[model samples]
Target: MRLIAAGLLLFGTLAPTLAIPPPTKPPCCPRHEVFTECGSSCPATCNSILERNANRVCPDICVRGCVCREGFVRNRDGKCIPPDRCGRDGHRPGDSSEEESGIRCHRPNEVFSECGSACPETCDSIVKGGSERKICTKNCVIGCTCREGYVRNADGECVLPEECPRHESSEESTKCAPNEVFSECGTACPDTCANLDDPKPRPCTRNCVIGCICQEGFVRNDEGQCVLPSQCPNSDAIASSSLLLAPLPECGPNELYNECGSACPETCDTFNGLVENRACILLCVPGCFCKDGFVRSKDGQCIPPSECPKPTGSTPTIEIITPECAINEVYSQCGSACPATCETISGRSPPRVCPAVCISGCVCRAGYVRNAAGKCVPPYECESNPECGPQEVYRECGSACPPTCRNVLNPNLEIACIDKCVAGCFCRDGLVRHHNGKCVSPKQCRIPIGIFTVGSSEELNAE
Candidate 1:
């Protein structure tokens, strides 16, 4: 009678839908690929499936109706006992948890995403020279490759693909002239080379054909061959021979780096955080910069120093040991007054310094505005207002502002507001802030947009 009851329990657990007799060994049941499919008969005490046992070595049999779930075995007294509760002395030699079996690789970026011997095979395939890391994606596909921004070189060291110089014997070498060298596969190499300080030196092209370019201090001659810098008429070598230096043209008002220094002069390092990669110390073709936030006026006049934008928490605080300015160039300061240069050129009111700490810089040209790309483009060229991010639009000096962000200073105010101007990007009228710090439309927004007061139009026009 006891034997019959135990057999009935096993049968019910395996096939509650069917009333067939319990088999001697578990059958190859349909696999539960998802956790939701693995249902529990008694969810309160025992789990329906052992997550560890959900792999290939274990059969995809059900333990739903009466028997205990996987990671558990029936005791002599007919009670389900966890693997830990089972005495080690009573346990058989082969009986062990999946984790104890030592088949899984617990390395970072590597996971056992699926049930199969295939994962083990993939792990084994990782020979010394092969992929250093292997990851199982969410879809259970094994992604074996080098880390981000790194490619395996011929020596098998995970180095930058660009830093690995191409030799004449390489496949890319045949595409270039005998005098030219293969720079990269589908990249834009510099047309003229100088020892300019490049923060990011990489290929700019996106073709698979590979690029052939001249080396540094060299230029492509009319014969399509690389020649020495001096040989090229337009090379404009700053240093003549060993000692003499070429005189730089005097820069007009509000310019920086119009002349050459002994080495690359450090400029734009401070503005990197406020404006992404806007300034750089260059060795070749140095000129005056309008700073990151400032743009030259259309009439070739500079904006007053006081009218520049302010730096924010996002702005990096880098200290340059020697802050050098070019001839007629103004040293950048926190609150330097702007020159009335634009007023004389455009006959408009002198622009005030952009509000915020360390926001001062050169003014933009008339009829043109600086876009996110940092290019001085016509006002109409700005298709949409500057996007602080997705779902955020620029709020002009007089435009309606969002309520949540009220009384808060915006980091990216377009036009300086002394009395009447409103500035910076804001969430759209119908949009609101989401929990993730992103502005979202009505559907995804947790804080729904509602009635809110904005700055009065009359007050805005009063300025």
Candidate 2:
């Protein structure tokens, strides 16, 4: 009875300790920062306007960090500041005052501008006479450019059209070979001996191309030499020569000799299925083809469609032989052109647009992706997203624009985000990513203290 009483006393002493849960670790962050697991890969900064206007592509990913509180953007010094004060101190490019002070037009007939034309007229462009279309970017470019009627010369100086140095005409310098001639624009497809008698009008581009071609009344021969039509070998002579050289193969019954035959000829086995969907090459094959209303049989004999053997049942049982695939993979006759690989699955570099084309092969099944070793596996099994940080979980298709401390307070920043999902680590609900790389509640985010300045007086003086 004494021993039993002692055991009961020990049990009561340890009961409370065992029932207690582990203490949660508080997030560590600097002043005015809060932890978050799902932060914008492309966070809004003082240069966000410039980057967005410049058409910079932002990576689709969720980053973990301690970001600034709402109604703020990161400045050059990594401090949160108001959006209105982004370019007030002249750090931004193309600033009016900065352009005026930094660039000086020393050359004659030159002027400076904050937003200059991207495609400025040059001596070379003037010489081309607008033959080629110039693709210009619709953005502000700060630089010194030639004045109104002047153009930039090869020596990098602005000059009048008449004052620019002249060169010999390209047509005068070009010397055509024996049967070739120079032309400002030439036919893309030239006539040859094979197509000389063909009545079909070949499709060609209307664009002008300058190059040498056979003289008028001549065509390229088999040896690639320009020859007149009278000098070309006659069909009878060529046929006789070929017969003397080698005898032609005897065609089977109902088959005829054809120089150009359909590569995907109708067969007894494929007449009901593959023949309808198969893609045939434009190039023709040289062989004997079966007569109309007949198809090649399994025994290499041509037979009528009605004479072909029919299925025994009303519903034919097509035995589809599925290919053996690796783990988490499935065979598909028309698979996606862009399959989910390790890089795409991890959102390292996902395709912006996938072509609508069919590719036959073994591919990863739904909810699975291919790994680095080329084996299909579940998305969670991928090595890239397996090491998610605290309070974060791996997602195959998370939001491209996740809520961060910078947008958590406002929640309606007029930033355009791609309407696509990305694979990455995302924070749990009610937690926001802080600038210092931690996940914490939104209320824990601290508001920045004191007024923000661009730079110190000493630094400005040094500059």
Error (Å) of candidate 2 at residue 148 is 33
Q: How far is candidate 2 from the true structure (C-alpha RMSD, Å)?
A: 23.3
Which digits, one per residue and each the tens of the lDDT, describe model 1 over residues 150-261? Answer: 5445544445545555444556545766556665343334544333223343323223334677655456655556766555554455332321244555666665554332
TM-score top scorer: 2
Which has the greatest lDDT? 2
Question: Backbone clashes per model, in order?
Answer: 24, 18
State in Å the error of residue 79, model 1: 30
State the lDDT of candidate 2 residue by residue for 4-115, as single tens digits: 3444455554322112112233367666566765565456666655445435444334455677677877666666777787877667643443232234678899887545
Q: lDDT values of the candidates?
A: 0.38, 0.62
TM-score: model 2 vs. ground truth: 0.32
Q: How many pairs of residues in model 1 come into backbone collision?
A: 24
